[model samples]
Target: MKHNFGAGPCILPKEVFQEASQAVLDFNNTGLSILEISHRSKEFEEVVVETERLVRELLNVPQNYSVLFLQGGASQQFAMVPLNLLPEGGKAAYFDTGVWATKAAKEAKKIGQVEIVASSSDKNYNYIPKGFEIPADSAYFHYTSNNTIYGTEVFEKPTTSVPTVVDMSSDILSRVIDITDYDLIYAGAQKNMGPAGVTLVIIKDEILGRSGRSLPSILDYEPHIKAGSMYNTPPVYSIYVSMLNLRWLKAKGGISVIEQENIVKARTLYDEIERNPFFKGTAAVEDRSRMNVTFVMENSDLEAEFLALSKERNLIGIKGHRSVGGFRASIYNALSITSINALVDAMREFEEKHK
Candidate 1:
């Protein structure tokens, strides 16, 4: 069996892919392919409506919260977020956790003032700086929910009185969360939901008009909200696949149940990493990510050998990210505990061989 550990566009439920394959050939009894189905057609509209509905139910989002499925990835929302949220000359606060957090801060900086309230970069982003003060007069406090590269997660979100926006591109639906607590949250569908080409945005309707910024039709959330995500030709196929994945999640007992499994899976792998003699974890003990576990060999030669060994064993994407040279085992929600166990067992077997 193949063990997948890729960071983004990570593993997904087997049933989801199997059902999605059927849809691609014959969608909703339309006889036409899912890809060729007109975006504005009834079959497609039904998919859009159900997908948005599933998102609301999964997130427990209130009526005050509006969901939009739009083109471009989470990177696009990095810029659109500040443009649509930050008032003129208003200062937005950001916590520098990893590459994505820095990218969001940089995009916001071009349109409004941004303050790096706190950063763990000095420690190579191995931990989240706790108890750092967020400015009282700031427009909003923003943070990346999970650091994919460094394998750190906030685990618990930071509290702020101001409007809070989270980049949940890698962590959304991994567990149950209080959706009402934040003013805005966005995630790219590729990792957890479906494929690329769609980005999911959930915003509090009350907080949007406060920015007083005129946004382009595509960038503005209002247009998409007003039309129920039908303003333009939507990513119908991607949305359909996302809908299937959401249904799979719901059928398997929703976020609460899946969260328990996620904790177990992460614990199983982390325990192995800590106990194993040859490999060592990279992140701080408290800030380890449930989504990505990054580690390296204590001996440089063993690191190369580990990569080759993993490849020979059919375990792929277990190599470290380029910026930080170490292997990252991305345990997204869809990655089964069995896959993680295989990796850990491989680590043990390799440790025995190396020693």
Candidate 2:
């Protein structure tokens, strides 16, 4: 069997793929593929509702928050957040740890002032920045929870009096997070949630309507909340698949249980990287991401050989991002511990052959 470790639109449970395939063939015994169903249909409406409900239940989100399935993915959220939350002449604080975080901060700058309170750019984002102060007057403190490309993650949320907004595209549902800690949390479904085309936004209802600027109807959160994420033809197939994945998550015990498995998977791979002399982890030890474990060979020349060896073993997507030339094994929530073990075994075998 092939082990997939791609970054986004990454691995999912085999059972989820099987169920999603069946739905694509025939959904709910309706004799209609999910791809053809209308978003307004009762069947599709139930999928959207259940998907949102599962999100709330899995995260233990308080009633004060509204869960929205939106279009345009998390990248759009970078802009919508500033348009809807950053008031006129207001400034927002951001932690720039990697590429995605920098992109988010840049988007916020277009709407208003953005203060990059901390950054790890000096070290090529091998670690998460710390000791940054969030401005009290800032509209919101934005941070990406996990830096996918750099393989670094902020284990603890930044403590700040200002509203906190997290772009959790890479780490959402991977572990347990206190939903009440932030004013907003948004993630692209392609990561731990589901396929591409759907973005999940969890916003505290009171935070809306505070932005003084006029937002386009599509960018505004109020209308989407009022319509229950059904405004302007939601990504029907994506939401359905998300619902199936959420069901799978619920069945495998909730986030808390899944988190333990993820911890084990990450440790197995990281331990291999640490003990194997042929490789060195890229990120700082403490800040290394549990979702994406990036590493480089001691001699860069060995990179291609190691990749070829891994491919021969049916291991794939271990290559890192292009900007950062190395290997990145993305062990998302759906990725099994067995797959990680296989990768670890492959690494050990390759090392033995070389050493």
Name the candidate that leads on lDDT: 2
TM-score of each: 0.98, 0.99
Candidate 2 local lDDT, 1-355, one digit each (tens)? 9999999898888998999999989999999999898888888888888998999999999999999999999899999999999898889999999899999999988889999999989999999877778989999999999999999999999889999999999999989999999999999999899999999999999999998877789999999999999778888888888999999999999999999998999998999999999999999999989999999999999999989989998888999898778899999998888889889998899888988
Mark the regions of model 1 whose C-alpha exceeds 4 Å error after superposition: none
lDDT of 2 at 244: 90
RMSD of 2: 0.8
Cα lDDT, model 1, residue 48: 88
Task: Report the lDDT tens digits of candidate 1 across residue range 93-205.
Answer: 99999889999999999999999999998988988899888998999999999999999988777877989999999889998899987889999998888878789999999
